[model samples]
Target: MDTTLLHQYQLVLSSREALLNYCETIRPEHLAQPIPSYNNDSMGSLMRHVANTYLGWLLNFLQQEQHPYFTEDNHKNLPAIRSMFEQVNLVVNNFLQQYKDDLTAPLNLPREGETKLTLTPLELFTHVITHEYHHKGQLANMSRQLGYIPVDTDVIRD
Candidate 1:
């Protein structure tokens, strides 16, 4: 992988760390509270969904493995969620190493009852990180709903 891409991913992780640290300050009940309007998605569930997207695309779809997705019951607390992201980091690192030679090589990913989805390694990486940021915004909004003022969790912050 290019050093630039690696550095960009590091910045992404740093922003994610900020979000997780903010989550640590929140009450467990607030993290677990279901927001009925948004399909009953709790903050924790959204975070897990982000992690699972990394696993689903990079690992399961890329490697053709059937890894089990994390459940709310199993990952009920911040530590468990952090650990899940640790696994995400590992998978991402492996992917970077594995595709260092051909980051732009196209991959035909399976789709249900449709044509296969084609993506390059770089595109896959971009997809996962962008997906995380999209949900990260939702998490901040969810925090506000639960009566907390969120800090800056972006890559460039004051």
Candidate 2:
């Protein structure tokens, strides 16, 4: 694998692991505590959404294997959320490995309306990485608001 692509995938995987570790520190009861000003998505829901984003994008957009995204409330609990993140990490990790050499191959994906967008595997993979990193920022903020410190998910850290 190219160093750059491997690094990108590593950051995504590490981000998921960081989130799982963060979940371990949270009180189960506080999993669903929502910051009203932030939005209706609680910590648990946000975690679930992050996992679902990986599944849905890979499946529906990137032509990967089909699997149901665990978006229901029951699957958004602390333990389940952690598991969902693992599942997502596994799928994406596999996808990245299997498609490493095809990174620049354009994908035939559709847009929301009648438009079409062709993206390289590299772009799709990057979207999944950036998407998780984006949520990790929100998760960090949410953690601080809830009186807990989120794991440092920065790709480069001491």
Candidate 3:
């Protein structure tokens, strides 16, 4: 892999691990608490969404397939948060192994009713990471509103 792709993947993996650890620390009851009305998503839902989003990106990367929007089924049920986390971790591991040989190839991302968008593998990797970070921020906010401390392991800080 090129230096940029390698760095982006490393950052993604590290951030994912950190986010999972943070989620693990949250009290079980708090997991079900609803986020504010503005978002209307429960903490559990947001967590599941983050995992599903990454999984969707991974599926695109490994299978070169187009997937639908994020959903609970895709996340293996956020109500069972631990299992969901395990599923996400498994997907990440599988993705790393499957794409080990093509880390430098450009990605083919298809959009609905639009031309396909192409990005370097490194760019796609970073896009997914940033996507995760975006949702993770919302999760952190929900956690804090629910009176829990959020994890501080951001890629920028790391």
Candidate 3 deviant stretches above 4 angstroms: 1-11, 60-79, 97-104, 155-158
What local distance difference test score does each model get?
0.89, 0.75, 0.67
Name model 2 segments beyond 4 Å from true.
Answer: 1-4, 64-66, 73-75
Question: Could you tell me every candidate's TM-score relative to the true structure?
Answer: 0.95, 0.84, 0.69
Mind giving the per-residue lDDT tens digits that candidate 3 earns over 64-133?
6565445554333334655665666666666666566776677777776998777765555566668778
Q: Write the per-residue lDDT of candidate 1 for residues 60-89, one digit (tens) a residue.
A: 988898988878764588998899999899
Better of 2 and 3 by lDDT: 2
List of clashing residue pairs for candidate 1: none
Candidate number of the best lDDT:
1
TM-score of 2: 0.84
Candidate 1 lands at a TM-score of: 0.95
In model 2, pairs of residues that clash are: none
The per-residue C-alpha lDDT of model 3 at residue 148 equals 81
Weakest 10 consecutive residues of candidate 1 by summed lDDT: 1-10
Best by TM-score: 1
Per residue, candidate 2 scores C-alpha lDDT tens digits across 20-137 of 6777788776778877757866878787777788788887667745687686664546677767766776777777787777788877787668677888878877787788789889
Model 2 gets an lDDT of 0.75
> What lDDT does candidate 2 reach at residue 119?
84
